[model samples]
Target: MATTTHSAARSGGVRLHVQRFGTFLSNMVLPNIGAFIAWGLITALFIETGWITTIGKALGYTGGYGFVEDLGAWGSGSEGTGIVGPMITYLLPLLIGYTGGRMMYNDNLRGGVVGAIATMGAIAGASVPMFLGAMIMGPLGGWSMKKLDALWSHKIRPGFEMLVNNFSAGIWGGFLAVIGFVLAGPLVEAFSTLASKVVNTLVDNGLLPLTSIFIEPAKILFLNNAINQGILTPLGTTEAAQAGQSILFLLEANPGPGLGLLLAFALFGRGAAKASAPGAILIQFVGGIHEIYFPYVLAKPKLIAAVILGGMAGVATNVVFGSGLRSPASPGSIIAVWAASPPGALVGVTASVLVAAGVTFLVAAFLLKLDKSNDDGDLTAATAAMEANKGKKSSVAGTLVGSGAARGNGPIHSIVFACDAGMGSSAMGASVLRKKVHGAGFTDVTVVNKAISSLTDTYDLVVTHEDLTQRAEQRTGSARHVSVNNFMDSPRYDEIVELLQQTNGAAGANGAAAVDGAAVGIPGGRSSGGGDLLSRDSIVLDGRASGRDAAITEAGELLVAAGAVDGSYVPAMHERETSVSTYMGNLLAIPHGTNEAKPAIRRSAISFVRYPQGIDWNGKEVKFVIGVAGAGDDHLKLLGKIAEVFTDSAQVARLEAARTPADVQAVLGAMQPA
Candidate 1:
């Protein structure tokens, strides 16, 4: 096993899982951002204490239209129920509940119906708007109906299928409605009471600024939407209804910290990070794409301190002046912040943004000046880290710095669009490329789409969305990887067609290069037939480690002793962990060194250690640490097999239960060509 195989590194709750959860929370709010904006505008313009009151008096319409009483129903004596009250109380919650249910049941209408029903009950039970309650019960109702149907779906009589489906959903929805109504009050009281108490205590004690310690780090972990949409927004809405505005909305959505960090980089950074800084600033400050700046902090972990201090400064400024926005600033853009500011609060909000940015800039500038690390500060690697954290390639990051280097200069005749799910965007992208290829008179070229996890090293080129490009490359490393921002309409489509034409012409002149699509940049095509790479000696039953770095060191040390990689490669493994986590979900983390350390590999090999107690890997729990060493650019097949194994929860359970080196080896054997 000396000349043979393994992998390691990556997490907060497994980055993908956290990101998906964040996405789920944001999805419930993002699609309805317009409705929110409208509501906010109406409240600001038509409230009895709002702008319309002053404008109407000046226009002498104070006596004419009852717009004051009818619309600005903020207790104008006549007392007409306004649009604002009903929209927040009923429309918004129902919309969120329905969307949540639709998503849970794979976007089925039935799920939406049940979800809305459940949400109505929760709304009735709670005194405030039931946004959080809708979030909870909507998915619960959908999941319950899904489980209920599975029980008797197959047993239903042929003619009564539709009848059963309708009545079942109704009956289950009503049942859930009652349950929601009963639980909503307790759930709200429990969460709101605790949260409100903490916030109130912080505000009263003048310690509200302290929240940045947790808020800043959590935002970097891609939990901004969950913390904002799921927690703060609901609480903020309640506060705003009671007292004109709430500071809770400003806590996470303020763009000042990110702005300061980017400005510092633009002024005093090195290499690609410095160059990308100016470009990132536009979106970070104006467009409010806060994600654009995360990679910068991740590249320089010390930068977190700057953002935290800046965040504290801003919160303090806002607190001192009682400055707050009328509505949530969805994008965290400066423009949005000002637009949503209460009548006379502009000066306070302005001071907050400026003070935060100034403090952050000063601190970050000092850090950058004192820095001696980062060999030219590789922003590409940092962006790669961001992509992993986000579970997709950031369009802004890719545009700033992302290009695929082809391993060959030969003709291209085969292309594949691969993704984890194997369908959706991959299928559509493949169809687009197929049309362009055939239209350009290169019908000899074939384009197909499939799941990246099962791909063979047979394609000449692979086209994938920037986020998916990394996983796609792991499967087909030899393929020319083209990363595009959009599938339906990408400039890369035309460029790819043009590339094929040029390569085809060159191959026609040099016949040898045209023999087969795989002839150029093909792998050694080695397939493990069980026990070729992993063995009993390489397996640790009850692995010991102090933490993530320690577990990685242990795995790498095992590979070193097995003669798979040079001792120097172990340090490189540590370096890899600093840039990106290797956690691949299902409690498995494959730690491997950087490409620069590839020369240290003796041959492909794997070292497996099962830490039953689980190690903390960048805030993610890791039960299995598998170290990998791929020789001669050979990783796809071995890594793909491991990915496939960990994907199945049942298989993961079996591996978790395995107590012996032999038992672990038996499971690894299942990954062979069988």
Candidate 2:
């Protein structure tokens, strides 16, 4: 279940770690796929050995004007003149470098300019187009600028900040450009040369079909863009320039396997998967959105074998017929694949796709028929798992009815404002939201700002700039993450405020009359029991722990002895910890049950335990452990007091010095009656 959500626990698996790295590499190029398509179109129709050049000569269109020959960049009249060579050589690599830089800097445009400037050196130094160099320099330039800025971020005077920033970026870019020219260009060029040699070796030895064993599984894991743009596109573009077409483009972009799998599900699958397969087929095959079928394969895990075999057959057929495409076929649509096929290779390309589709359909149909159990794979759970891999919800996943797509498990009472640096934009956003929240008479809701790296699972809602939203979600898996472009004003803020108002209104309507919260065990909401939140007996002065798990268990025991929660809720506390770290900075750690464990609460209570040895908690030191159990909203007040005390380092220091349970209670300013 920990793997089902984005968290530190999820990163424990080696496959998911590789998947995330691949996804990052692909994200830099996926945004600029349109430029690649445009370049492909021009190269296919107008190159010297392309479709137009072959036809124009027979039709006698190549006249004294030299239009056909010029367009094709041949006949010694035009050598480096056509849009094909320059676009592939210059435009594509620059775009990739710029996008990579922006990503590393958290969407700051200054980072992009610096990165592009640095990438120019690598491009000039390399003999080829420098696509690989661009990938290296772009992110490097952006990250360098970020670290440089952090050194003196707030040190500049108010009016001179912009001037310093602009000059600093220019100077830093010039320095990196020199470095990239001297180092990165040759290293990346040599690597790209090696890659080309490897691909040629595989093709010559008839071992190219074996690539499907890795490619098919990677595509299912949503690493298709990484394998295509980050690797195959650059290599294929170079091959196409020398030869008329390259078979590398057809490896991952072959849509036949996905089409066949969906067709099989449409025929033999049960329930929503069967009904959705027909609609998904149109989206996956014609629309060129291969991801539309990933849920189907993931749901039935056995279907992977079918796609792998089908992909192998397609590659083998293409290799045998000497078939290849002029450029990458993105989205892996049947139409794009056909359109990108070389004029002379149409028949062979057609045969390859048909054969792959036929093999996959037969294999998938057999697997579905063999399943005799009433139970089948659940599409909803699979889609959720897919989104977990994606790090965010997919718009395509919504077309399926049973996906259960929702953010955050409980009410949005605690909202966090995060940014690249917590001091600037996030602070402003939190201030604006706090104003709106208090203005609407919902003063109980808490809004605060923090650095992106400092985010914790204690927050129910987290707001960050659009570029930083993915980072925020990676840190706090269960939090409902919201991305807003502007800190001063955003429409999303209004939507959030409205949602809270409507939710509160619904709650008010549901229980118009007075009710007893203590008797019924009010779950995950505020109840009206205002008793003493802490007592002397609830404080433990001599408890010690060796690790995070042991410390959390001890905290849960204190709550259970205080008669705040049931014994079953102890495991729930561990669940919450695994989802995200509960270590609140300032030598403090809060251990509490998950939102689902709210029913186990008998009443609202708070407990404190002091660790003399200071436990090691996920690389952080913790000397104080606070246990929380809230019946309704009563526990929030106690939590708020602790939060306030921790903000002042002096008060925290005083609390840490206390030796007895009574002294600890006095430091907290909460001395409960006996």
Candidate 3:
């Protein structure tokens, strides 16, 4: 009978694990669809509107325009366009964050607030330490909120009314969001201004040549006529023709800056420097996506100083000369700048480009040399430590026990060792059993050490010490429980080996075998069917002795001892207690594992801790404690069970007043399973 029960439990666990994997995959992929749609809509709106053309004209372009024709005006267009684009992008992140938070934390308001905070952090974090800042802050903010919620709101709160009223807890979530944006805004503006100043200072020093090369001609073609005259100058009827003529003149200017930018990249860029340089030159010289140089800037930020210095010098030289162009530079070429700007403007643009390039080159070379010299500072010890740690982490096995698998006595393919605390003896026992099993020639079998409460209806067989057998049995109804205090002292090891041999013999004879048996008893005085299992005994003590806190603590420890939870679980419980009391509508408190350490173990057990006096739980007095543990995909099912039982006002009243361990068990036994 025991063998049958164990086999059935193992099969159920395997199914549960597969279902969990499916749910996880769904969560990862489904949310992104909404974000993609939102981005697409914003992009389409930009393409449809004429805002791009108007902004380009305002920025000093003279050619006929349409939305799609002007790429530069997309990001930094008019105030209206700028506002819309960013707002659209912002909505997607906010939605994803809020939805994800609510689902994970079980508090909608807090989740939404956390999501908003994360968005704010991401925005601010993007500016300072560069893109990495955004990546770190977003995830960190989310993680912090999750821990906070788990620690406080779910563990400490007493009643349903109190837990619901504690929604105000989310208000604190906005604090980080506010701080991140405030600090990031000023820093980004400062960096932009500093970048501009660096260019000006280098030009003033005259160490770089003042000859318009790249940007000069592009500036003359685009900025001179439209921004300087068409848009900035009076636009009355009398000035219309002059505006057109000015536009034509700027268009015809020399494209010196375009050439200079190309030359700078060709000379300095590391990868495919020569090839990329000409390509960059051709693109800037004709297509005009100034952002093309951004990658180069990232590869070597110090190069920016030189680029700016060279640009300033080249612009100054072009200004001092009497070079100019008559029309806007369409293809930012030297010919275009000559055609667009008058002689003086042309020379100024040329001079600025040459100066910026030279400054950029020198700064880049110096920085590279300095970096090489400092490369050997302190990395050797760090690398060795990291490699050693990596080896350990990799050696740890993944969760190999699948759900819905039968436990058989046949050559065991897998062994799941469980105990109450998941620490101490259970772990040691598992290691010993695994070695013995290996010695029996079943080398391919996998052995896992876990807390008893975490034992699901999965695994070929579950080997546990005596203390945890009942809890394991209650949790995974069909799992075959092999109660062993010590593998070395017990005859169960030989029994297991004989069972395997018998199954193999059966297979050889009839092509079918009884692979596994139900819960097997050792040939010892102490058996799983012993009469020592605790029964109901009504005893009322000072509520303090058996209060919610005491019960939860004791139950948690028992679970840990049984290998149902980890020893570190107390901290996780405390953290949950801090957020709110987990005690819900009735006498039940659903305490879950908050950290990554015990996320896969989940079991429901009742600890009848009687208190002589009740302890203050939020505003209510509490006596009994019911400890709930569930993790991974079982979270929802566990929560559903709590919700169904506690939602009944009558059921809660009886549970709170229950007197003994058996009485506590009776209350749970009477409740309908969700």
Candidate 4:
């Protein structure tokens, strides 16, 4: 990976902190998905749709059904709120409190119990459901109890531990419960009333469509997760409890924009993109993967206008019909939106989506027409010009230029596209990169998509949108991190390929220094210059190693071929594998002989093998195997230096991507032991 730096101005003030708090609240609810689904299903089937009433009538036992027939209230949405109503009213607060507490206390039950008990007070005597109240009291109770437990643990007698724990919890729970009822309840109710008024005002005035203006742009910027999950979902859940539906849920959950964009591409796009667009339509509408179409809009930046117009059309149609959803449409899939819509609102929702798609198609057609000629040209050159223009605007571009030199002599072997959930844009980004890499004839390279939370040091490069750059950097320490503004754009892919080529070229050259002025070349001492430790004949550019044992034997024979070790070294390597596999992560492994097999070493030497297909080292992937042969601490020192080199994911990436023995040797030769 090439060395490039990016800096984003961190927004400050109360608004930023409030957004962070909203993010924290959303994160707490995310882990308790089972609970939300239960609530949503119960509310959707029994209470809102009155499916229970229909079932009762079918069974010929109906009081609710009798009222429906007599009063002509078949779709009144009044099933007396049902069992699920109380569940949302009473049980939901406890669940939120318990989950929030568990989150605060590292998922312990102690905090959960306290949080659940404390939140009951907030719901006491409250006319409406106290979801927001629970959000506050639950975490607070858990945190307070945690602090109290820590204090008592230090002071309490060992024999009285159990007794003290129960009594302390009882006392704290009692006090917090009172505070929740007296102080938190009224405050939360007042805030809820205020928010309801604001929403109602918008709905009444027919100005609710204005929200799409901000929503569409934010969603394109990949703020969809934060906006939908963090802000709207929470608010929608509360509203759904009262109204039996919520337009807030439909705001960001509408997939019309993405669907429209893909429809246009499927009909009008050229080349592979045109072919892929047809498949994307099914994935977006039926499979509920709205992110499948993000790349299409990203290919031509002007298509964002189409997306915005489509989103607004959907929102306006939803508002005009007074259509709302029973729950948030997760994945923003059309099916999910339909399932969540109120009874009799499905027609309106479907029509809105179709209208939005049609409008987007017209707008996208115009945009594509404008760029049709340039679409087949060198996209990389255009991207390069765009990047150079950005550099000119940066305040630190001059300073960055000095540090923007190529890094380690490694090519990118593995690239991981990471996002918040890893399902949406990140997956598409990986697909885009995979196509580009294969087109470049780098078949050995692998590209995978993952959630930011699961990222590790094993990958050579991490590709993330600008919003996630900081988190990606923190997760993948030494791996090269690339930040792009849009995941769907082609230019970023071209830039990555160019960087890989530059690093590959630098690897073959001797005595080169990277951006940090770190010496990167063949590891030296007496090895390459005079000693038998390093030899050109000892390295295999592409080995036919099938498995762990085979890869080690192949590497050991390189030493045998060079006459640096005896036959005993082969079994020694096997014995070492038996005790503990030598697979060091980052797709590289060190197959060294056992410490007791020191006598088998004729002279300190190292042999390298690059497995293009990658060997299954035990259960781990092994792309590079460096067999060690040294006496005393010589091999240990060599192993340490090799660890230093391979640890830079960029270097390993280069080695894995290298096609020839000379290319592989150049990368290995550039390693400077730390």
Candidate 5:
């Protein structure tokens, strides 16, 4: 028989090992380690006070106990614990949100708000539909601000935009929270139950020896009627309760298990382990929330296994020693447990904690040493090489254009355009350039109109009117720049057209030379009426028509042709209508895409329509109608850029009075790159 290679089997085994290790580290070790430390601090405090005995009596136990009997009474009765407990609980969520948000979005405070909103929304929108809705809306608030900033850089402060965006995001977050509370609570409980069952099975089968210890005690505590009635019952009551209960009942709780988990983390977790572990433990133990130590255990799985083993030992010790606390194991703190239970409960808690801490420390120390040796052998040199490569990649872009000699490569392609609102000139310029490149016609072409910030390094040649050049240059990093004069009549325009002709001519010549019998002549001669280009149905507005009249006519014609609208739309043009227009900052006009109607159009599409003679709009004669159609969320970038171009009052005046399609094109050509 041929010898069979077990490559697949070996790979599967390795993957299984990694997954198991990863799960232990992420789910058990990191989180619980912090919880353990917190528990330790709380337990130590409880040992000092005879609080456990009093707590037992308050819960209906009659035995001699010196501590507080009612868990609820302690807070209303004592101001110190009340303030500390609530404050910690509230701050923990915020801290988590802040940290996560900062990590993801580069420390933007608004991102923290968004993160908080997202977290809260996640909690509230527990139902499937509500969750989906919140997720969808959550990004909108942040995204809208981003869009506005992109559209109107420098004109508006980023901080103000973020504030507005976050405020809106908060409202949506609240809605999401409500949904989550209603839908998620039951689901979370169900999932927790399922998880508990799985954990129990692992313990029963000895598959998870370490975790079994921590979980088993809790399981038994939850099931025991004596512990539940004597401890949990009284603790669960509100301050207004009329309870005649035992005075010295035992709750059967141990703080050491939780504290030991934290010590385990400090021993093995990476970076600031010593510092973070204590803080993590304090929060988890007193707060009764186990999530605090999650990150630590997640940093190292083997360490978590050890911590879990320690927790099991601690819990087992408590159970065997009959050290049960009254008033439940809640608030996980030593003071709360001691004040609420019998003396034996305190002993049980102490013994369990010591055993757990001892086991975790020894196990974690051994693992850390082994891990250090492996890392030293495998990672030191590789890490240094990676750092070097990253540095080189970061500087590549700056190196490309450091010298003057590299700038002389004349732009490979030239583009020309026409638009209704000079406001959209920049957007149209960018869009056409992008489309042309997508068509594979010109890879290194320059796109220019009145707006220039739309230009990117991807372009080599730029041709635009004089007004937008300064702004354009700033964006393009002082790239080879040229200004157009008289629009089409300028020397730059002539040069560009000549370049196009030469390129086409050369291609034609090459094709002719390659084909032996092909005719070396133009296939379609210039037509009589300026050919099909001119004959393609022009909607001419009267030279004396109002801006609204012109806008409505243009919008109707374009929409009807595109099959997006029915019937004529009378444009809503009024006095000062185009004065402080959407073209305020950019050479743009925010004319209605079409008159408002039922069954709205899906997206905004611009229609380029020019007047042979100017019409007055907002005290200025308007010659163009750049129709703007928008719905759903705002496209602030597009609007802001349009406003920027209109900032040049002289350009608007020139555009309104321009004559002929070619002349209109030339005026557009004359507007500088923004």
Candidate 6:
């Protein structure tokens, strides 16, 4: 039945659509992350006021490290210029072109070569290295190559295909390269000049801190790469060349705001968040992986305000104290920030970071006032509800009708990991799931990562972050959708694993064998008329239990009385409850013993109990409690049946309204096996 919702899971609201566009922009820069880090390292070590220069000078006085001093001198002077200039002029363009080409068509060399050619042309025509030219020309060149290939592949003679291919590529490459040199050169220069002017104006006018209002929010939305590599780095490069340092380096590279938010969550948050926040703080602050803090803020979106305030505080502090970085910090780590801080500006940098953290901590603490006393059950329930209500999230087995088009049916052949930028978190997530899938022995299932625009109806399942759920669904026509609030810690993977197992099992059997839904009697036998596993003794018209735990115990007692399982199963069920709520949605929950308690089952049976007043199955209201006891995989059929029942809201309403044990028996009898 999947999970029933109070409202349909809809996608493609104006905000989500805007996010999709932003995500596309981010992806253009994301594939070149390794290159950015390399550039950052070079900029940090070789610039005059950079870390290497300061360290080399200090060591030279202490130990006569003349070679180190000379190296720093060369790095800070002409040698550094020789290195950084060619990097932007030649290598960066080629790398970006190749990646952009591959993004359009996987395992194709032609697109990459074409893109590089175009970028080289752009560089030749430009006065500067033309970083933005590479971005535009690379994708343009690749897409052009793909279109040309499609046009020529079918029409050309088979024997002379290679000749045609080579000639066509050469022709296109030369033309585009020349075109880029002519048109892209002037266009890139104009853009770069305008961008630099705007940034310089802001810094000159003392409005540099106000940039955080945009930077902080964009970072949370996974646009850090776009803002950093695509925009700030170019401007920073020009400024660093002139003044030996640039405040632009600190714009997206500041980790203070993220650290502050994590600290607040660590101190004042509840459940998994509180426990996870400390580790996140270490990763974000010390390790300088700012991506760690992104999910934390995403979990509670209001926390973005705190990060913005903190960023503003840090930027303002940098401005007041005249603290600037010789280069951009790669990971935005505190240590990296310190290393890049100008001479005698370490104190100012430290003060800025501290103030930012303190301000963010206070704001985040006020925003995220979590209750420490909440139990695991409540926490799980609250989290589930959040996922359920998340925009356009649905399983293939069910349709969540709302504003979006109804999704296609699926046996789930292909799984896609989608995000704002396909290369970042989505790629990592795909690898994680791919490993899990291989471990589970589903070697045939294809797992891929892609940007939202790249998604297609051919995919069976789409896993995406909560913030991008609607946009993902909007693109994933009829594909089963699942969203994770914390991409790092998605328990839903366990469910997907189970589904895969079932899928494999069905494939092996080569038959759509039926699993029982509402069994009433002993294994391989039914009661005279059909009300078998669920007898009157097992059926409770009015549950005597006041709470979810008590109701589960009541159901367990009935199961034991029916000889389906023994006394040990009760505690086993309780323990399972602690790990994950058994709530399956549609006012229904299927509570059962742990996997270790499989031996406790004497025979397969179900004890159906109605809790009219409703016991809190975590935070969800569970009216129907089906306590199941089965020896092996025998219980799956019954679970499937229950899912089917839950899918039909009318059927669930009928079952929920059933008054007597006889009426409940009738409801169970109505579920015929498939």
- TM-scores of all models? 0.64, 0.66, 0.33, 0.53, 0.30, 0.54
Number of the top candidate by TM-score?
Answer: 2
Q: Name the 10 consecutive residues with the lowest summed lDDT in model 1.
A: 515-524
Error of 1 at 367 (Å): 1.8
lDDT string for model 5 (1-674, tens) is 12244775675566445443333222211222243224223332343233454455558766632242232222335422432222122332333433344323323445446545554544443321121222222343233323332332222232343454455557644654454456543464354345445634653564533434444233222222223322223222111011211111222234554566567555654445554566666665665444344333434444556656666676556546645443334445665555544444556656665786677677776777576432221222322232222211111122211233433244355443322223333333433233323233333344433333234544445544454454455445424456542321235444554554454332232222222111111112122222211111332333323444345355445644544334332232211121113231122333543123323444333344555554444344445555543332122233332332344466566655655454433433343321
Superposition TM-score, candidate 5 onto the true structure? 0.30
**Better candidate by TM-score, 3 or 4:** 4
Question: What is the per-residue lDDT of model 3 for residues 107-139, given as tens digits with 9 covering 90 to 100?
Answer: 334554565565565455443222222222333
Off by over 4 Å in 5: 1-304, 314-355, 366-670
Query: What value does the lDDT take at residue 448 in candidate 1?
Result: 75
Residue-level lDDT of model 2, residues 315-405, one tens digit each, is 9999999999987888688899888887778888888898888899999999988965322357877887777666556668866644353
The superposed Cα distance between candidate 6 and the true structure at residue 141, in angstroms, equals: 0.5
Q: What is the lDDT of residue 95 in candidate 2?
A: 90
Note the Cα lDDT for every prediction shown.
0.74, 0.74, 0.42, 0.66, 0.39, 0.66
TM-score of 6: 0.54
True-structure RMSD for candidate 3: 20.2
Q: Candidate 2: where are CA atoms >4 Å away?
A: 1-12, 54-65, 71-80, 149-175, 374-377, 401-674
lDDT of 4: 0.66
- lDDT ranking, high to low: 2, 1, 6, 4, 3, 5
Task: Encode model 1's per-residue lDDT on 103-193: one tens digit a residue.
Answer: 6765566778899999888888877778888888888777677667546543444345567889999998988888888997568747776
List runs of model 1 lying over 4 Å from the truth.
1-17, 54-65, 74-78, 154-159, 372-375, 402-414, 417-449, 452-674
Q: What C-alpha root-mean-square deviation, in Å, does candidate 6 show against the real structure?
A: 21.8
RMSD of each: 16.8, 13.8, 20.2, 16.8, 18.4, 21.8
Selected candidate, larger TM-score, 4 vs 5: 4
